[model samples]
Target: MSDTRNAPHVDMLRSPLGRVRGLGSAHRGAVTWWGHMLTSISLVPLTLWFIWSMVGLVGASREEVALWLTRPVPLALMLLLLVATFYHMKHGLETVVEDYVHAAAPKFALLLAIKGISILLGLLCIISVLRLGL
Candidate 1:
């Protein structure tokens, strides 16, 4: 341990090149922050509409449910929610895997698996919603 008064403290907000002594990659914090903001903004209305629609279906009959789901706008919205939800899940899970998984191969494998499963589940849910509409 060196003298605390003279030692420099790490600044997390600074670019890697500014803080680091040697080689550093270009900063991507802003890009990641924008991506997160976009996802969050898109999810807000999608989640609200999905919950509201489900509430409306609570006591609906089979035909009523089918008709409601089959409408073009609702079907499209449902599909959009399915895709967006899965994408968000994939992004979150990737962050978790990257943070916790230490080994290279396992991290890569887990990330790939999460992405694959998210896509598959998203597609399945979309198909089910479409089928209900039909």
Candidate 2:
């Protein structure tokens, strides 16, 4: 009984109420993406610096290696590398799990685990670095 040409448009998959209630997409696409990119970009230089520092310490004795870490430059850069790499890894996994894992429960669980483990590992590294400096 309705005129097809004059009918209002409606999204079949998502209801109008859903849109009004803001129950879609989570609006975090750009933030998560940019965080990943920035961390990745930062990691390039940090990783290179770490490798360069390692090369210098390659033939050093245990005490020499410990002395290197006790220095402020190596200590700070190492902590930066730890934090940035962990954050980068966490976000990368989050994007992958979010895209591929469709189930809500599993997706949430995986993200939580990834972030939690990443934080724990990063903290452990930082603590170890600080202990060496102290």
Candidate 3:
């Protein structure tokens, strides 16, 4: 039997330095929450404007449509919507890919491909909108 006074004691819950190292501050999750909120709020007005504009054009004549689209303000808004939509989509798809794709190489490749496709599609949409405006 060992003497109790000379025995080493281990506290399972506490370390000698007082706490575990490398465990960072707790607010990291809030960043993602805020990012989602910001993206959502931005999309709301853009989506409403796009839908309203389309509804207003439902029965417009070809020339009238052309004239409306060619205006600088609408054209600018369309461009902004195109960019914001693609950015939002990229963020969402990236999250999905990160969550579901377990393999490193395939995950990275898929993410890169998604980004490429989103950029290309956004550019194409901008060009098409511009051509219509022109």
lDDT of each: 0.81, 0.83, 0.81
Off by over 4 Å in 3: 1-37, 59-62
**What's the lDDT for residue 81 in model 3?**
87
lDDT of 1 by residue, 25-131 (tens): 43334554456667788889999998999999898898897898889999888887787788788888887897799999999899899989998998889888888
Candidate 3 residue pairs in backbone clash:
none
- Candidate 2 vs candidate 3, TM-score winner: 2
In model 2, state the lDDT of residue 24: 42
Return the lDDT, model 3, position 25.
41
User: Whose TM-score is higher: candidate 1's or candidate 2's?
Assistant: 2
lDDT, residue 95, candidate 2? 76
Q: Using Cα atoms with residue i matched to residue i, what is each candidate's TM-score against the true structure?
A: 0.70, 0.73, 0.66
Question: What total of clashing residue pairs does each candidate reach?
Answer: 0, 0, 0
Candidate 3 overall lDDT versus native: 0.81
lDDT of 3 at 70: 92
User: Residue 85 deviation, candidate 1, in Å?
Assistant: 0.8
- Arrange candidates by TM-score, descending: 2, 1, 3
Query: What is candidate 2's lDDT per residue for 1-134, written digit by digit as tens?
Result: 66788778765544566556645465433456668888989999999998899899888997897799989888888888998898898888887898899999999899899989999988998898888877
Q: What TM-score, to 2 decimals, does candidate 1 have?
A: 0.70
For 1-134, candidate 3 gives per-residue lDDT tens digits of: 76788678765533433343522243133455457677788889989999999999998998887798799989888888888888888878988998899999999899999999999999999998899897
Indicate the worst ten consecutive residues by lDDT in candidate 1: 21-30
Where does candidate 2 clash, by residue pair?
A: none
